[model samples]
Target: MRGTEPPVTPDGRYIVVRGRLWRKANPALDAEARQTLVADLMKARRAVRDAVRIRDDMSLRQARRSVNDAKVALGERGPVWWTDGAPDLNRRLARNTIYAEWYAALPEQP
Candidate 1:
């Protein structure tokens, strides 16, 4: 997560961060569409932080929903975007899954 770009899986389905697998945004999305979604996502994330700071339960819920919606639209959550029948592995530690060998071989990040 500290790097400009995390190490992505060989198949491009996920990016490895802090030894965990996170689903990537859909590659099929056009640049404009992806940019727009990412903007909305960042806005929602800021709202989440603000809500937590102020202890506003209602705003927190709404902001979280916005975050979830953006993530879904970005193909990072809810359902698998790939058609290859692979199981969703979002949030799994890379060392515990099929990517263990590959993950082990990556150069250590500072």
Candidate 2:
């Protein structure tokens, strides 16, 4: 897949670019990394929602990139999941640690 531009969903209602799950829950996406992630998600979301006339254009790499972006965004560096400062249902996870942990164990960079 060269440039699906957006790895759309099956029904076209949402995009699964990354585990960030872009659709209705899309937030302010305040950071540079978050912004980039949001951009990728939007592309995938549009692909599903507006991909008509064409099919099978998105590549797995793009989809994975989007997902990674989201994952990073979801991590602590992106935003706090809640204002209460608690790791509850609506709390955002810690970023620096999460990101570090993710790569620290990696055998090599992709």
Which candidate comes out best when scored by TM-score? Answer: 1
Q: Give the alpha carbon lDDT tens digit for every residue of 22-93 in model 1.
A: 999999999999999999999999999999999999999999999999999999998888999999999999
Q: Candidate 1 — which pairs collide? A: none
C-alpha local distance difference test of each model = 0.95, 0.42
lDDT of each residue in 1-110, candidate 2, tens digit only: 24544333232322333222233233444577566666766776555544433544455445545555665464523444445563322222212322335424534322
Give the TM-scores of the predictions, in the order they appear.
0.95, 0.27
Model 1 TM-score on a 0 to 1 scale: 0.95
lDDT of 2: 0.42
State residue 95's C-alpha deviation in candidate 2, in Å. Answer: 28
